[model samples]
Target chain A: MAESYRRSRWSNALFVAPYLVVFFALLVFPLFWGMWLSLNKVDLFGGGQFIGLRNYARVLSDPVFHQAVRNTVVFVAVSVPTLVGLGLFLALALNKTTRGSSFLRGLYFSSSILSVTIVTLIWRIVFIPNDGLMALIFNVLGLEPIGFLSTKGWSLFSVGVATVWWCIGLPMMLLLAALQQIPADLYEAAALDNAGKWRVLTRITLPSIKPTIMLVAVIQIVMQFQLFGQALIMTNGGPAGSSRPIVMYIYETAFIRWDVGMGAAASELLFVIILCAAMFQYWISSRKEVA
Target chain B: MADRSAFSPENLTANRTLFWIAAVLAALMLAPVLWILGLSLKNNQDLMHGTDAVFRAPYTLKNYADILVNSQVFGWFLNSLIVATGQTLGVLTLCSLAGYAFARLEFPFRRAIFIIVLFGLAVPEQAVIIARHQMFNWVGLHNTHIALMLPGMSSAFGVFLMTQFFNAIPKEIDEAAMLDNTSQFRIFWKVLLPLTLPAQATLGIFTFLLAWNDYWWPLISATKKEMYTLTIGIASTQTNFAQSEGLGFLSAQAIFASLPVVIVYIFFQRHIVTAVSGGAVK
Candidate 1:
């Protein structure tokens, strides 16, 4: 019996071994390796030498990194709240609808599945000056065409627009599921109190979905914070560096400029920001729960 | 929730308004895709014209034919297929094993190992890309489809999602299997595995979508054109052809490129909605 038990234990370890090897080698090791690289000046040819916190300091002082950070903030600021609000609105709308909502749910969620390349390219075609879809619509309405992707003022907003369109699907689905999970009695109780739709939405629906709202909020912040391929493909952070996000900056630094130390530092900075945002959301969600 | 009363006038009005709003939102979401499809169906000459002229005469499938006949899109499609399918199968298989171990088994340092894996949740792939590239290069896997699939294969999210799922499967089932002198592995494969089909489908669709839509990592890893997935290959080809072949062919290629995943999405969207929300609520 003891021998069989020992053998079973070994067999279980066999099941876990491959994943452990990868978990350590890929996820854990590379993370620490990246950290180590950040503290050293690594060349493609030459071996690294420790340069301490200079890379972090340099990233702090760099204008491009500063711009990237601000751009990321702008993106999150624009997209995150919109995503949460729009997701909740659509979820409620869908949840309330008496007809054909399941089909509409699929329609709303379709764009979220598209590749960044497809999404960006579609938006690019949509936003082209005179010959684009928006331009055609403008022409029909007797309005001047807007240069969404080309101009400085509208560029980030344009990316934000594409992003919101592409992303709202998942959040909407998540929020809708959350909405469906709320017991019908609670809403009925609210209605019996002579509550209006707005009142029920605030007092019952919002409070019921508070956790899901936080989940969607955190997901959006982390995702929007790492805005890369959109800016890379759509605008190339263009017009005036208004849309180049920190992740793109990290990509440029590590790959484009081949500055491994700086890339690592910038990545670490982004990591810290994401971590803070996540922690903040955790605090907010947990505090409400405790109360 | 809308009032569920069958005959109330107010309820009927609310439902009508909801349906109208949904119809408009759906149109807004799908109009761009339909417009691209219209552009693809237009002749080469119509490519230069605005979306207003997209409906005019001289419609042709020549652009589609040219992209199919004259480009390496077929090869890019194959590469994407190989990677997405491979990554999905690989992630699902590996995550099931590890997740079962974490969720069901008792072993030395299980908590510690699980914590380490959980730690990966906070670390984005971008944070480790530089090191991952060097690691892959050291292993001679650079510029390969394997490299493109590798980082994504062993995701902490997969492990976390699967473990949560496995934890939900009642231990009574496993214990009953054990009474028949059945092995743990057998229970995992034959009994519990069959029960977790919905979860597996969810993970499969999620992984497949992430793998299919993945752009940045492939862009970095697959330097050789033949190695490029559909997105990177199309992006590269779009530049070369945009100035020479005009936007019609590019539109055709983009439409062709997105079709398979889009089709899969339409088919499996139910699994996707439930699974994503599974993570959100539970």
Candidate 2:
């Protein structure tokens, strides 16, 4: 009996071991190894010698790294709010259980289903000066077609626009799920008080779903921080590399330039920036809740 | 006053306004996709003429045919299918096992290990991507679909998701199975696993979509042309076509690349939404 009992307990370890092997090797191992690599001058093809903090120092001084960091921040700042805010507003409008609510939800969510390749490709076609969708609209209005992808100033912003369109669905669906969870009685009570729509939204809807809103916002920031393929495919981080995100910079650094240490350091820098954003969000949201 | 409640003039106007708002928003959202479809149907001569020329005459699917005949679109599609399916299956099995163990079994240092997995959740791929690439290359898995499938197969999110689901199953079921002299494996496989289909579906859809739509990791790992997944393949095709194949070629390729996920989304829309929102709330 005792032997069989011991066997079962050990068997439980067997079940988890397969996952842990991969987990340790790919995730935990890489995590620490990357940290170590960040400190040294890593030679991908050969041996590496430790040169503490130099890679981080280089990242701080590199103009392209600075540009990538700035560009990533700009993307997260603009795109995160647009996606989260637009999703929340749309979710509110669509949560009323009207006939079109479900259909409209799917409509808004369709673009999100597309792969990044498809999303970028579609926008690439649309952003073409005289032959794209915007062009069609511009031609109708008898206006000059904007060089959406061609111009240096407009490139990053255009990438953000495409991202916003692709991303709104996830947050919208999340906020909608939270909305569904809100007790209908609260709304009935607000209605009994003859509260207007704005009052109901502020006092009832927003407050009730505040946690979810924060969740959506935090996740949005985290996801947006890792932006790579969009600008890579759409702009190739171009028009003077204005749209180059930090991840793209890291990719080019590590793989293209084969500067593993410098790339790892930049990766660590991006990780810290994302962590700071998440922490900042929590701090602000918690303070707001208390207030 | 009772009669005033149902069809008040104010409510009627608000309803009309809401309808217009929803209609315009829907149009804005769907217009780009429809415009892309229209653009994809236009031939190169039509595309170069102007935006208006597309609507007038000369539709052609020669671009689509040219791509299908000329390039490895189907090969990329098949590769994407293989990796996405393989990764999803591997992740589902591994995560469910680990999740069940954590949720059901009493073990040493389980909490510590689970915390590490949570850290994995917080750590984005960009954080560890360089080392991951190096490690994979060191293991001789570079330029292979296995490399793409391997890193994603052991996801923290998947483990967490499955753990939550396993925790929700009544402990009495496990106890009853134990009382019946069943081993832990049997209890897990027979008693608990069958009950977590909803969680499995959600996680499966989420994983499949993620693996299919993955761009960056695949872009690096699958450097060889034949090994490229749909994303890397289509991205290259888009640029290559920019100079050679024209706007219609790019649009057609975009549509073709989009077809699989779009079909999956239309069918399993609820599952996708639930998985995302569920993961978010946690």
Candidate 3:
């Protein structure tokens, strides 16, 4: 019996071994390795002198890095509210058992399934100056075409618009699910008390879905903070590097310029921001059970 | 409460208003896609002059024909297929086994290992990507399908989801098999594993979509055009002014590249919705 128990323990270890190997080698080990890489003066070639915190300091001071940080913040700031608010709004509007609601839900969520390349491509044509869709609308309205991808703030805003269109599906779906989870009796009770639609929405609907709202916000923040592909393909982080986010900066630093140490430091900074958002998400999810 | 009755005229008007508003918003959501489709049918010359012509006639299939004739596009599609499918299978196997172990098996340091794996949830890809790229470079694994598929397989989310799923299954089912003197691996293989098919479908679809849509890692690792996945390959094919000079072709490629995911969305809409919402809620 003892021998069989020991053998079973070993067999169980076999079940976990493959995943542990991948988990350690790729996820865990790379984190510490990246930290070490950030501390040294490293590159693609054989150059590794212990540089201490200089890379961090340099990255913190670089104008381009500063711009990337600002741009990333602007993106997260703009898109998170838009995605969360619009998602909740749509969820409320469509939460009813109305005709064609499911089809509309699927229609809204379809863009989220597309790749960033496809999303960006579709938006680029729409945002093109003079002859694109938005420009055509502007022409009909007798307004001048704005250089969405060429101007500075407008460039990043254009990326944000594309991102909202591509990403609104997620928060909408999540919020709609959360809405469905709210017991029907709550609304019935409110109606019995002669509550108005606005009153019921605020007192019952908003409070009921607050946890999901936070979850959506945190998820959007984490995702939007890692703004890489959209900014990369749409504006190419152009108009004098006004729209480049932190991930783009990290990619350019590490891959394009071969500044491994600086890139690692920049990446670490990005991880800190994302980690905070993720932690907030975990916190809300953990508290969700109690709430 | 405005009568608070489903059949009331006030409520009827409100519901109609909401439906109309939703319909308009849905149209706004769909216009870009339809416009792209329209542009894809129009000649590049006609579009270069003005996209307004897309609303008119004289559409052609030449752009799609060009894409179909481009063997490189198919090569990239095949590469994406291999990578996405390989990543999905690997993640399913590794995560299911580990999830089973964490959920049921007795082992030394199991809790510690599980905690470590959970911690991986917070570590963003950007943090490890530089070191990972360099490690792959040192080992000369860059531009390989294995490298493309391996990192994604280290999915903490998969392990977490599968573990929760396994834990939900009552132990009595497996215990009965154990009473028959069946080996533990067989119990997991023949008995418990089959029960987790729904979970597997969810995780598999999520992982497949993620792998298909992944861009950053493949962009760096698969620098060689031959090794590039469809996302990277399609993006690379876009010239500086392809939107103007080759507008129809560009639209065609975007539409083509998105077809697989669109098909998956159409087929697995329920599973995809449940996975997205349930994954977050749980």
Candidate 4:
């Protein structure tokens, strides 16, 4: 029996071996490499000398990096709250509606299936000037065409709108599922006490879905901070660098300028931001549960 | 349940208003997609003429004809199919083994390994693209579909998701198989594997979508135009055919590119709904 148990233990290790190899090689190695690279002045084709904290200091002093940081903050500021609030609102609205609710839910969630590429492509055409769909709509409504993708002031906002639209589906679906999990008897009980829809929503539904909401918020914030494709494709961080998010900056630094070291530094900065946000969220959510 | 007599007439009116509002919002969400479809069906002249002529213009299959006959889109579609399907199979097979191990087997540093895998979920793919490219180049796998299929084959999300699903399966089944003198590998294949259909489907769909829509890696790795995926193909179509009356053709190509995934979704919408909702349960 002990021999069999020992054999089983060895089998278990063998079963998990492939995953451990790949995980360490692909994910963990690059992560630690990135951390190391951030601290050194590494080149693509040559030997790198260790330069402690210089890359981080350079990133801090760089104007383009500063711009990317500011742009990312604005994006998170605008996009995260909208995504969370709109997701919740839509979830609540769909939850209340009994007619064709499932069908509508499916339709709303279908947008999420279209990869970020497709979403960006569709919106790129939609936001094009004069001959574009948005322009056509504006023409019909006697409103001037808005250069959503071109103007510096509105470029990030336009990308934010598209990003929100692309991502809102996931949270909406999650929140809807959470909302459905709430016991109907609680609502019925509240109704027995003459509670109105708004009152019941405030008293029962909000509190019930709070955990899911917090989860969605953290996930959305992390995702928004890594905003890349839309800026890369739709705006190209153009019209005076207004829409250049951190990931785009990282991409440009690594691939375009061949500054792999600087890009690694930028990515490290992003990792720190994401790690902090995630830890704070974990703390907040756990605290709420304890309370 | 409350009696109908308990609610006021004003409450009924308000409820009706709210219901309509939700319905309207749902319709509005679908408007852009409908308009894109409409625009694809119109000719160059009609599209150039703008929204007034959007519905009034004579619908034509000319754009579709042009794309089908003139472009490399069909080739890109085939390429996407090869990559997506290969990556999906790879991820499913690898993740199932890993997930099963993590779920049922007790090994040294299991929790540490699981935490490492979970951390990959937070690290966006873009963060590692530079290092990935360097590795691919070092291995001389650059510019190959294998390069695309390699990184995605061992997904952290897949392992995490499948682990959750496998954990829910009772251990008694495995014990019963063991008592019957079945090997552990055979049990995984013959006993536990068949029962993980829903989880497998979920992983398949998610993996397929990720592989299908990947643009950056393909863009970086694939230097040749023939090697371009659908996303890069469409972007280049605009630039390459800039002077030609190709907007309509571009739209047609876009629609064609989008069709496979749309058809897949339509057929498997229920599975997708279950899978996405299941993800949140993680």
Best-fitting candidate, scored by TM-score: 3
lDDT of each: 0.80, 0.82, 0.87, 0.77
Give candidate 2's error at residue A88 in angstroms: 1.3
lDDT of 4 by residue, B159-261 (tens): 8888988998998788877777877789889999999998898789877877898877887887677777777777665553322244566667667778877
The all-Cα superposition gives candidate 4 an RMSD in Å to the true structure of 3.1
Interface RMSD of each: 3.8, 4.4, 4.0, 4.2
- lDDT per residue for candidate 1 within A106-182, as digits (tens), equals 78888888888888778777777777788888888999988787788798999998999889898888887677677
- Clashing residue pairs in candidate 1, if any? none
Error of 3 at A63 (Å): 1.3
Q: List pairs with backbone clashes in candidate 2.
A: none
Question: What tens-digit string does per-residue lDDT give for candidate 3 at A1-291?
Answer: 324533436557899999999998999889999999999999889478998999999999999999899888978887899999988878876776655777888899999999999999999988888778999999999999898999977999999989999998889889877877777667666766777877777787788889989988998899899889999998889989999999999999999999999999999988888888898899898999886
Better of 2 and 4 by lDDT: 2
| Positional deviation of residue B176's Cα in model 1 after best superposition, in angstroms | 1.6
Instruction: Give candidate 4 regions above 4 Å deviation.
Output: A1-8, A44-46, A96-99, A284-291, B1-15, B49-51, B240-245
- The regions of model 1 sitting more than 4 angstroms off are A1-11, A96-99, A284-291, B1-15, B49-51, B240-245, B278-282
Tell me the interface RMSD of model 3, in angstroms. Answer: 4.0
Q: Between the candidate structures 2 and 3, which one is better when assessed by TM-score?
A: 3
Q: Candidate 4: deviation at residue B132, Å?
A: 1.3
Give the per-residue Cα lDDT of candidate 2 at A235.
88
